[model samples]
Structure formats: structure tokens, C-alpha cells
Target: MIEYCLTVLGFVLAIVGRMDNLRGFVVLPKRWIVERFFAHLMRSRRLVRDFERSTTSAEAMIYWSMTMLMTRRLARQPPRRG
Candidate 1:
């Protein structure tokens, strides 16, 4: 059931092409998204500084930061209606 819903959504998004600009070229939504995510991550003082020496730890901090940010957003927003 979820697969069917996801397949349908893929078709719908393909038609919409939200990633495209007026010239039919792919816009840099990913770059914008990454930049925005980092902006939020920087709100954490630990992330703002290069305190983590290990790459694994840095990546973990990023994941932890994103989790906190998402949970906070989810808490603020009402649940979706079907």
C-alpha cells in the first residue's frame, strides 16, 4: 500500500517538476536546502566551532543537530490530515 502511494507520488512529482525553473533547467534546490540546514545546525554552539576532531563524530553531530531541529519543527506543527 505504501509502495503504491509512493509510486503515485513519484508520478505526480515528475509531472510537477518542482526542481525545474522556467527555462526547463534543474534549479539548485539541493544547494539551498544544504545551506539552510547548515544555517540551522550552526545554531548549536558545538557545531559552530570545529571541536569534533574525528570525521565520524562531526557527522554524528550533524545528524544529532538535524534530529533536534526536525523534532522541534514537528512539535510546533500540527499533524497532517489525510
Candidate 2:
């Protein structure tokens, strides 16, 4: 009887632990999404042409340039040694 109860409790604990992992992995789009959107924008001709002819082009260029710089900086930073 004691062995059966311990087995049931272990099963319940396993189910709860898996549920926590599922919740932790689910995330909303944010920084990674914005960067990816611009990375795609760089490949697209529509925005490139529009930027070439419009006043907003400078702003778009600056924003994308800064974002790219930041991405590079983040990538090269050494991980904490501690």
C-alpha cells in the first residue's frame, strides 16, 4: 500500500514539473521579432526603394544601422566568468 501511494505521488510530481517547463518555454514576440523584421526588410526591395525616395529613409537607415550594431555588440560580449 505504501509503495502504491509513493508511485502515485511521483506521477503527480512529474506532471506538475512538465507543465512548468511548457509554460517557461512559451514567450511573446519582442526584441528578437523586431530585429528579424528589419533583417527581412533589408532583403525586401519595397522598403529599399521607398527609403531611397522618401525623407523617412534616413530615419529607417539610422534605426537599422543602430540595431545591427547592437546585435553585433551583444554577440561578441564575453559570457560572465563567475
For model 1, what is the alpha-carbon lDDT of residue 50?
97
- lDDT by residue for model 1 over 1-82, one digit each (tens)? 5566578765332222363435665547666776787799999889999999899999999899989998998889687899
lDDT of 2 by residue, 1-82 (tens): 5566578765332111233545445534454576786766665444555546566876777577667667877889698897
TM-score of candidate 2 versus the correct structure, residues matched by position: 0.32
lDDT of 1: 0.78
User: Candidate 1 — number of clashing residue pairs?
Assistant: 0
- The candidate scoring highest on TM-score is 1
Error of 1 at 22 (Å): 15
Task: Name the runs in model 2 displaced over 4 angstroms.
Answer: 1-51, 79-82
Q: Deviation in angstroms for 21 in model 1?
A: 16
